[model samples]
Structure formats: C-alpha cells, structure tokens
Target: MLSNTIGETKTARNFFGIHLSLSSDMLRFDIYKEDGEVFEDLAYRALKIAVMATKRKQIRNLPGYYKGVLRKLIDETYFKDMFMYFDVPLGDFYFPENYEPS
Candidate 1:
C-alpha cells in the first residue's frame, strides 16, 4: 500500500518520492491534489498509509520527495478515477521499491 523515501526535523503532513534519504531527520510529507482532482477521504487514507509505510521503512529525504513520488506514481498509474488511487490501498501508484529499516 506504500513504500520508499525519508526525514530530519521530524515533521509530517502527508507525502514522499524515490531516493530514500537514510541520513536526515527532517523529511517532507505533503501531497497535492492533481488538476481537477478531488481529494477524498480514502485518498487521504492511502496517503496516510504511504506515509506510515515510509516511517516503518525508516526512509528519509529532502523537499521535493513528495513531488517525485507523485510524478512516479502518475507515470505508473494515472488513475481513471482519482479516488481509484485509493481503491486498493494506494492501488497501483506505489513506490517502485520497498525499503526495510536496518
């Protein structure tokens, strides 16, 4: 349902990307609604899961990480129904790889 990426100053608003930063404490976690995209509850839930997934993996990163993830997900699965992104637990739009904390 979620995967990849990191943090430094210990703040989370909901988001990530690739290049999991494993050395910073400040991270970015803000997601944006697409053009004409109606962000629903499930969508937010999916984001929540994704964020938790990142934390579980202990992934870290700088700004733009959320944007990067969004871009990658769009390339992977541009949802026919925007809420569909939340259909199967952040369905299809997933982090390319999973990172397990060490």
Candidate 2:
C-alpha cells in the first residue's frame, strides 16, 4: 500500500496551523481561519524563493546539505521575519530551526 501520511500526527499537514488541501496532488496546506481562506500569499512567496535558489544552484540535492544552505540564505536574506511561519516542503527536508539565530 502506498501510504500518504505526512507524519505520525493527525494535524501534521496543516499549513501555518490552518486547514486545507491541494486537490490535484493530495497535498495539504493551511488556511486562514478568520476568512476561511488558504494562506496563498505567503506560500506563493516562499515557493518563489525556493525556486530561485534552485535556479542559482545554491542548494544541492544531498541530504542535510540543502537545508544547511537554505538556513544560510535565510540568514543573509533577513527572512527571519517569517522563517517561523513557513513550513519546509517534505521533498527538500527542513533546516534546523534552532540553528543559531542572529
């Protein structure tokens, strides 16, 4: 059986603590409860940054390495303003959130 669970928890797929789902791929995302809308704006922005990094080859496919590079970029970009608000995609893994914050 092809298990599609995101993690061991029931609410693991919630994006930014909101509830929603990607119909085409079965991927879930968070929604804004106040307006019952998904967080498209921030998600879109984050995805764009990710794509740009891929184009520059600033990230590698190796495990852990890409995350390390991402953290560095986040640092350089002063993205700390929102780092805690975005969830790293599963395919790319994730950077250690505890990595010394400046």
Candidate 3:
C-alpha cells in the first residue's frame, strides 16, 4: 500500500521547484529527460498533457494531470523497462497565489 508520509514533503518541494521553472512553451520539446528513448517518450506525454490543459485554460489542473501521468508511468505493466526516478505529490503543482495569466 502507498504511504503518503514517505518522502512526501521532499517530493512536493521538488515538484514545486520544477513547476516554478517550467513555462507553457517548455512543453514543446522533450526537455524533462536527458537520455533514453523511453524517458523521452514519458516526457513528451507529460508535456502533451500540460499543453492540452493550458490550451483548455485549465492550467490549474496540471498537477492532477501530471500525477495521473506519473502514476501510469510508475506502473511496471505500463512500460516494459521504464521506472519512475522520483515522486511528486499532486498538491505541489498548484499555481502561485498571486499568479494571473496574461
């Protein structure tokens, strides 16, 4: 069974850091992973979801989308040899309190 307290705080911080660094335009390329075709594919999928969510003006849902993507990627049955390198809590990807899309 999954335990929320296991590395949850660290994961949330890491994901929030990533969210801060990312822009919608960054989704146009496979920038999340450095090497490996599978990794690239995973990055592409995540970016695609982000792009779609942005287009729909549902940017707030990005964290949930990413969480779903991560969950799927982490499942051994979902990929032959791919594995999650890290974990990120869905709550970490929230938009900044003062953020206003321009």
Please report the candidate that would top lDDT against the real structure: 3
TM-score of 2: 0.27
Please give the ranking of all candidate structures by lDDT, highest first, separated by commas: 3, 1, 2
Q: What TM-score does each of the candidates earn?
A: 0.29, 0.27, 0.32
- The lDDT of model 1 is 0.40
Top TM-score hit: 3
- For residue 4, model 2's alpha carbon misses the true position, in angstroms, by 22
Give Cα-based local distance difference scores for all models: 0.40, 0.39, 0.50
lDDT of 1 by residue, 1-102 (tens): 232232432333334222223101112323332422332333344455556667667655523445455444443443456665555764455464675546
TM-score of 1: 0.29
- Residue-level lDDT of model 3, residues 1-102, one tens digit each, is 011422366645544444434422244457624334554455456646655667777556555666565446534333455435436666677798899879
Candidate 2 local lDDT, 1-102, one digit each (tens): 001322324323333233123221222323323332223433334434544566677664322332343345434443357657767765586569786647
